[model samples]
Target: ALQHYHKPSIFNSDQGAQFTANAFTGTLKQAEVKISMDGRGRCYDNIFIERLWRSIKYELIYLKAFDDGNHLSQEVSTWFRWYNRQRPHQSLNNRTPDEIYYESCL
Candidate 1:
């Protein structure tokens, strides 16, 4: 799909064992994509994802007790919509994630 869309690169998750496996590394190598890993025990290495988790937990998860998977999924979707479209982020100069993402394209 990425190739079909003419996408150049992809960066991702290296914490999981699947990402560390020879098969996975070989696939990326075959595609000539750069492989970057977070430094061991360095929380700041993945600050963006960490911050996202903090925001979700504090702003949504902590505010409610979900009764089931369906309820939790609905709440999570709503939270993500607000977070991406409305919530201001300091790292983005107070712009929302969607705003920053689109701004970068220009």
Candidate 2:
């Protein structure tokens, strides 16, 4: 989806090991996508993703303790659904990410 809907021009991510790995970079390059990486140790350069991680951990991960990978996956999926639908975000003008994104498209 995102290509079918938003069709973003660029994709950006932090210079983490995962993003730097050949597997990840190769896939993006194959898609003819331009990749932008944050400078090392520059937290502010990736503030949006950092804030998203903080919300995910604090609102979901920190509150739950799972027994196994399956359990964690289920709970995380549920939490992500709720986060995108129900949770209001300050940066989004009190709207959930889904709401803001779809509304902008309209």
Best by lDDT: 2
**lDDT digits (tens) for residues 1-106 of candidate 1:** 4467544476566366887899878878888877887876677888888878997899889999999999999999998998899988887789998998788789
Measured by C-alpha RMSD in angstroms, how accurate is candidate 2? 2.2
Expressed as tens digits, the lDDT of each residue in 2-106 for candidate 2 is 456554567788888998999888877777778998899898999988988998899889998899999999998998899899998887789898988788888
- The models' CA-based lDDT, in order, is 0.82, 0.85
Q: What's the true lDDT of residue 93 in model 1?
A: 89
Model 2 error, position 96 (Å): 1.5
Task: Compute the lDDT of residue 53 as modeled in candidate 2.
Answer: 90
